[model samples]
Target: MHRFVVIGGGAGGLELATRLGDAFGARRRNPQATVTLIDRNPTHIWKPLLHEVAAGSMDPYTHQLEYAAQAYWHGFEFQQGELTGIDRAAHTVTIAAVDDDTGREMLPSRSIRYDTLIIAIGSTTHFFNVPGADAHAFALDTVAEAERFRRRLIAACTRAESNDDALRAQGALPTHKRHRVQIAIVGGGATGVELSAELRNTAQVLSAYGLHGLDPRDDIGIVLIESGPRLLPALPERVSTETARLLEARAIDVRLGERVTEVAEHAVRTASGRDIPVDLTVWAAGIKAPRVLSTLDGLTVNGLGQLNVRPTLQTELDDDIFALGDCAACVWPTTGRNVPPRAQAAHQQAEFLFRAMRDRLSGRPLRAFEYRDLGSLVSLGHVTAVGNLMGGLIGGTMFIDGLFARIMYMSLYRMHIAALHGIPRMLLDTLAHWLRRRTVPRVKLH
Candidate 1:
């Protein structure tokens, strides 16, 4: 049997591994391939929902899927380790040792040999070398990071209210004046925009829970700063305009064309010499492939540290090695640019690779990948979303918003679930989550 090793249990990686395992691994009557998935974390959560986690609108425990359970059900081996190095010549990948929370070793370092290797280790936040950014700002790259941000946000709100109460008692603050807790999000992309909207709702929920004394709308200030002239530059201008309008209506301060020069402990300094005071700061400016990609022996990575792959999703110099998702820089012939690093792009690439891998196993030719532009969507809280639907079916680009767009935005996550399990399980999971929501607080108070 051929050995298939996939590094990274991300959205694209997990989906591809599941498909391959179901089709060719031990689950099949006549197994042809032994599939293995390697990831640093023991569980998987959709990257798009990290913002919601940070805002405390979603309970991560309920949504996170255990990698070990997935592998058991799909007939694949799950390895919890970080990719340390790749040896293309030996066809072996080195995994670093894993440690428990108490610093005890859980798994020792080892190398896994593979007949075919797939690299899907996704991107990390790019701070662009801003002064103090790495030390002062938070990035929503993982569940742990998102949880940290949520805790900090809660603490900040509580501390601000406490300070105000003391000042009022001493007659230093007037009764009419409210203490402001400002949060600065350093990006106007989907993550920052969605997070800002979710935080607005979070403030309201926290007030309703009686966790803070300050008024939700009047005291909680969310500022979204973007260096670009408009938000969501990847989308059309109309969508950006509407998203900006919606956010501004919610009292979110949208600052466009202002580049961040420095991040202080309690403030963000802009290129225009504006110093915005903040209680908490989140960096969602951009993303680059993990630094480990650059250390890969003899792999040709692009400027973004992504492996450069051909149209067939194989590395330029190695036929046995393949890459997908945000970590792979694959060209789009239609625009003469690399495919956009979006979940939709990754899903399409994974589907393409599933068929390509089947052909490779059967000694057949692999076809080139053709990416279809499916447009984009940006969520504005739970009630509304803004995006354009593109394709021949829609007869070009049709803009949508409000509740209908919100439903469409949600269906994307459902589709990911259906890809892993079947449509039936996805439906059950949806119903279960909906029922659970009725019992839980709108935002995590603790």
Candidate 2:
């Protein structure tokens, strides 16, 4: 039996393991292969939804997939540990064990050998060595980080509401006579943009609970800073324009062409010599692969820590190894640029690798992976969404907005859930969430 080990149970890795287990694990008495999946977290949350989680608009428990339970149902084995190092010569992976939240010693630091290894460990926030950023700013990279931001946000609001007199005496009050919480998001990409909008909506809901004189539109201030010349610069110009208009309409101060040179306790300094006073600072600007990527033996990574992969998605230095997702640098032939790091691209890469792995086992020629640009979509809270879609089957780009775009944006998430839990479970989960949301407060109160 082939010992197939997949590291990082993320969007791409988890989906691949599930499909492989379902196909190979449910055989007669004997199984064709053994599939093992390892992850730092016991539960999986889709990365794209991290912003919503951070903004307190979504609950992590409701969306998380328990890796152990998922493995039991899908015919795979789940091991929880943090990857520390790798030995290519020994074909082994080193993992460090620790106590779980329940104070149980799960596993010790150990090594696992694999016939085939796949690395899908996603990227992490790169603070660019900005002073005080790592210590002060909130990052929406994981559930813990998101939850931390939400807690601080609620506390900040409560402080403002209860201490209005002191704040007013300090002349912080605007002409509108509303209590305010100033939040600065230091990135204008989809994550920062979506999070600003989500926070605006959720903060409004939070104010209804005796949050005296707090008005989201008038009081809660959201400032988005982008170093680039425009928002969503990677997308179409029209998309950027539409996004800017939507954000502006929501009273979000979108500061274009502004770079943060320094971060302090209560403010951020721009390159153009301006101090933006803010109570909460969020760093969503830049990202690179985990620093561990650079130390992996026999693997070639770009300066960004992305593993350099061939057209077949195999590591340039090691054919027995494969990589995908935000960590892999797979170039696009048409644009001569590396494939954009997106969930859609990751999903496609995993699908391609599924076939390629089968061919490798069968001693046949493996097919190369190609990225298909399916346009982009950005949701501006619950109010609106905008983007374009393009697939070879659909001919040219198709414009979408409003409710139509919202549904499409949601479908992307549903597709991820469906891949893991199947249609019946995914539909049931969706229904349960919708019903629960209608009954509970929109923002997390605790």
Q: How accurate is candidate 1 locally (lDDT)?
A: 0.94
| Model 2 agreement with the true structure over 277-315: per-residue lDDT tens digits | 889999999889988888888688998999999998889
Q: How accurate locally, in lDDT, is each candidate?
A: 0.94, 0.87
Candidate 1 lDDT, 32-136, residue by residue in tens = 999999999999999999999999999899999999999989989999999999888899999999999999999999999999999999999999899999999
The candidate that achieves the highest lDDT relative to the unseen native structure: 1
RMSD of 2: 2.2
RMSD of 1: 1.1
Instruction: Give the clashing residue pairs of candidate 2, or none.
Output: none
- Give the count of colliding residue pairs in each prediction: 0, 0
